[model samples]
Target chain A: MKTFLFILAGIISGILGGMGMGGGTLLIPMLTIFFTVPQNIAQSINLVAFIPMSIVVTIINIKGKMIEKKGLLKMIIPAIFTAVLASLAVGRTKNAVLQKSYGVFLIVTGVFFIALTTIKLVKKRKAEKENEK
Target chain B: MSKKKETILYIIIGLVAGFVNGIWGGGGGIFVVPLLVYLMKYEERKAHATAIVIILPLCIVSAITYILQGIYNFPLTIKVGLGVVGGGIVGAFLLKKLSNTVLSYIFYTVMVAAGLRILLM
Candidate 1:
């Protein structure tokens, strides 16, 4: 069942990841909730799990002609800076707290993403309406 | 070329993502994609690809840091690593058939739902 859950978690993370939402939201909790793994272990596992997903997405997108080289050049540094710090912190957390943290983070990120998306949608609708006039 | 701006943003995002990744284990892609697509005007695909590039370095750095700190678990990481490898292949192949717009709607929707579920549950 947990294997299935991990697979499901992988799928969910992959799909959401490809779509540009942060994939960690799906993955972190899935690791904790479904597998009953330790938090530190799960966090590392999440990264381990996500690494392949990120690479595959990169490779396929690159093949499909999705990668924008110029954009990549511009974004690489800042992205790495944060990723490194976050990875370190993940190492310190306990399993139980990590589990709850995953849940809490997911909830917060989910709400934030939705709210931001809605705002964008609303602004877009207003823009279109103005343009049509 | 806004070298300063790009560099500054890169550091800030990198610092933030790194700190987050230390604890969370995922988001270099998550946060970076938006930072690139929304803030840097990267197309969706480009932003994602860049996320990979960004993650690669952090992966190495973090792995090393954890090992040095005596917190790293190689045997376990290896197993999960194997899984991620396969998963990446699957995700890559799937990318060809899927539309980002459609994917985005689903992604955003799921995230929203996740948020709601978290709040309620």
Candidate 2:
């Protein structure tokens, strides 16, 4: 039963992630809240779980020639540097503190998405109205 | 943007996104996609594709760090990882048929609710 729940959580998060929504945000919380997984462990699982999915999609995207190569290295080099530093830092941070901070992050992300969606919806409606004339 | 400014912007974007992904274990792609689309002037599809490419390496590095830190559950990760891969395929198909705005509304609502629950816990 416990194993089933974990897989279910993964599937749910994966579906959203597959659609390019940030599934790890949902996955970590689900693990912590439903299964009582520790924040650090849950985070580790999320990072690892993302690996195969990303590899497959990335390969497909490359095959389709969807990736834009311009300036790619500029972004990748610094991102790799900081990601290593931050991952090490997270290893030392307290789990409770990490959990609370992640909560704040999720709320901010939710609000940001809501605002973006609302603006898009309004613009889409206006465009449709204009087209009717 | 000028060439120098664009280069600086890309680095800044990468640094922030990587930090967020490493600390939080994910969500960097969400941060990257919009920056690529709005600031970098990438088309939406290209931004999404590029964001994935950028995030893949970040996740790999972060995962390795976490494993080295001994923050890993092998059996659970395997089960969950397989399920996620299966669901991801389904999601890819759904993306073509669904109205993204409607999906976004639902997704964000759940996110806000989940956030509140976590905060209050």
Candidate 3:
């Protein structure tokens, strides 16, 4: 039963991720909250699980010429540096602190998305009004 | 944006996204997508695709770190990973057929609720 739940959680998160939504955000919360998995372990699971899933997508995207290569290295180099440092820091941090921080991150992400959606809607409405004038 | 300024901005985006993703184990793509779209003038679809390119390496690094730290559950990861791979294929198919506006709204609402729940847990 527990294993089933884990797979279900993975599938749901994966589906969202494959659709271009951030799956790890939801996956971590689901595992920690429902399954009582430790925060760190759940996070590790997300990182690992993302590997195979992303490889497949990245290959398809590359083949379709969907990826923008220009300026990519500039972003990737700095990101890789910081990511390494941060992952090391995770080992020394307390689980509770990480959990709380993640909670805050999720709220901020949610609000940000909602705001973006609202802005798009308002712009569309204004454009329609102008068109009808 | 001038070439130098644009380059600096890209580095900043990378720094922040990497930090967030590494600390949290994922979510760098969220930051990358928007920054690429609104700031760097990338089209939405291209930004999404490019984000995967950026995040793939980050996840690889972070996952390796976690494994080295002995924080991984191998069996659990494998089981969940299989599901994720299968679901990813389905999701890719769905992306072609479905409009994301409604889905986005629902997803955002759930994220907020889940965030609150996790905070109070």
Candidate 4:
């Protein structure tokens, strides 16, 4: 049962991760709430799980020639360094605070993405209407 | 933007996105894709692909840090990792068929649902 649950979690998060939205947003909550894992461990597991998904998706993307080489080159180094530093900081944060802060972050990001996408959709619709006319 | 200016912008996006990934685990792509598409003028598919690539190192470093701190659950992570590998392949293939609009709608719906659930419940 436990293994099954883990597989389920993996599949759910994997799809999101592969899609480039980060699987942890859903995986962390699923772990904490359903599986009763602690916040820190859940987050850690999410990171670990991301490794394989990232690798696979990256490989696929590479094969499909989907990446923007210039953007990848420009961002890779800075991204690594900042990730290392922030990860170290997370290692020291309290679980309760991390959980609350993570929740709030999700809410803000969710609303932001929803609003951005909605506006884009509306703009696209207007453009289509104009074209049709 | 000029080449030099664009490079700087990408760096900025990387720093912010990387920090978020490090702190949280799975949301770096949120910042990455948007910044790449809007700010850097990348195609949607290219942004998504590049974002995944950028996330790889971030996840690796963060996972290592968590391991060093002795916070990881190895068995669970490994199990899920196996599943995600297959899932990732599936999602990657799906990208060819899916439109950017469809993808964005899915992302918005999932993000909002997950956020509201976590925040309210």
Candidate 5:
């Protein structure tokens, strides 16, 4: 049963995650709301889980000839500095505040992307109509 | 793909994700993960971890930016990271058994829900 549950979360996370919906959003809430894991554990698990899954995705993209190695090289150094330093800073906040912070971020970003996409779609459709005319 | 273009993308994404992660424990994974995967051609898994790895450095740069003014909640970060990793393992393990149909449906549901959650809020 535990294995079954893990399978459900993993598969769902991987696919949805692959589709670009953001993995942590789903997993964090699932772990906290349903599974009742501590927010800290769940978040840590997310970081750790990302490690292996990232390896898989990297391999697949490489095989598909899709990864832009140049782009990654540019982003790596500055971003790593942020992670380590940020990790050091926030290592002591309360759980509720952390989860809520993540929740709010998820909610806000989800809405922003949806709105942006909708607007983009509308513009595309309008352009299509003009072209047809 | 040019050095200049990639540099702009990295700096922009880094600053944005870093600020958010610095203020909130959420980090760059939420936003950049998808951007890299869908727009930049990163694999899903790589997109996710790369967000972290990328954010690590960006956050440091960002932190340096803020060091003169203030600081972060380090111990809390450790706790949150623990939760993220633990849940991640469990989540990853469960993912293997689900049928594609069920899995996709769940994925869509999450996307819609996340979209709606944002839209409504």
Candidate 6:
């Protein structure tokens, strides 16, 4: 049962991650809530899982010619450095604090996603209207 | 934009996005895609693709830290990774056939639901 859940989580997160929408948001909650995994470990699992998933998806995207080299080159170094630093900091935070922080992160990002979608919808509607006129 | 200006902007985006990713293990692309589109003037598709490549390094770095901290679960990671690999292949191919806008709507709904659940927990 546990193994089944893990595989299910992986498949779902992978599909979302493959879409470049970041599957951790879903995976983290799923593991913590359903599997009784601790928040920190769940997060770590999510990160580790991403390594293989990202590699596979990235290869496909690259073959599809979707990747822009310039954008990639510009972001890789600084991103990696900061990512390492933040991860180290996460290691030091207590579980309760980390969980709360993650909660806040989710809420804020959730609202942001809704807002972005709304804006896109409005713009799309306007574009259609202009096209009709 | 000038080459130097564009380079600086991209680096800044990387810093912010990478930090979030490192802490949470995902969602960095949220920051990367928008910044690439608005600041770097990349097409949306190009931004998403470029963000994926950039994220590989960030996830690796962060994952290494988690491993060193001894918080990472190797057996589980491997198991989940296997499933993810299969799903990723399917999703990637589906990208060509699926409407991204529809996919994004689904994504947003999930994000909001997950966020509310976490916050309440």
Instruction: For candidate 2, write residues A1-133 as lDDT tens digits.
Output: 8888888899999999888888888999999998898999999999999999988888877998989999799999999999999999998999999999999998999999899889878999999999999
Interface RMSD of each: 3.7, 0.8, 0.8, 1.8, 7.0, 1.5
Worst 10 residues of 5 chain B by lDDT: B65-74
Error of 4 at A62 (Å): 1.6
Worst 10 residues of 5 chain A by lDDT: A12-21
Could you give the candidate ranking by lDDT, starting with the highest? 3, 2, 6, 4, 1, 5
Docking class of 2: high
- Residues A63-118, candidate 1: write the lDDT tens digits: 77766665444445555555555555656656556555666666566566667667
| Candidate 6 local lDDT, residue A61 | 73
lDDT of 1 at A4: 53
* DockQ, 0 to 1 scale, candidate 4: 0.68
lDDT of 3 by residue, A12-129 (tens): 9999999898877899999899988899999999999998999999898899899999889999999999999999999999999999999999999999999998898889899999
For model 5, residues A59-102, the per-residue Cα lDDT tens digits are: 54467564445566556655555555655555566766666666
Number of the predicted model whose TM-score against the real structure is largest:
2
| Model 4 interface CAPRI class | medium
Backbone clash tally (model 6): 0
lDDT (0 to 1) per candidate: 0.61, 0.91, 0.91, 0.79, 0.55, 0.80
Every model: Cα RMSD to truth: 4.1, 0.9, 1.2, 2.1, 7.9, 1.7
For the record, the alpha-carbon RMSD of candidate 6 to the native fold, in angstroms, is 1.7
Q: In terms of TM-score, how similar is model 2 to the real structure? A: 0.98
Q: What lDDT, from 0 to 1, does candidate 2 have?
A: 0.91
- TM-scores of all models? 0.73, 0.98, 0.97, 0.91, 0.62, 0.93
Candidate 3 chain B lowest-lDDT run of ten: B87-96
Give Cα distance to truth, residue B121, candidate 4, Å. Answer: 5.9
lDDT of each residue in B1-121, candidate 5, tens digit only: 7767767877777656655655443436677866776567777656654664454444344444333333433443344444344454444444455534444444435655644443343
Model 6 chain B scores worst on lDDT over the 10 consecutive residues at B110-119
| Sequence-dependent TM-score of model 5 | 0.62
Judge the docking of candidate 1 as incorrect, acceptable, medium or high: acceptable
What is the C-alpha lDDT profile of model 4 across A1-133, one tens digit per residue?
8999889888877776666656668888788777878888888888888777777777777888987787676787898888889888888999877877888887788778878878888999999999999
Worst 10 residues of 2 chain A by lDDT: A55-64
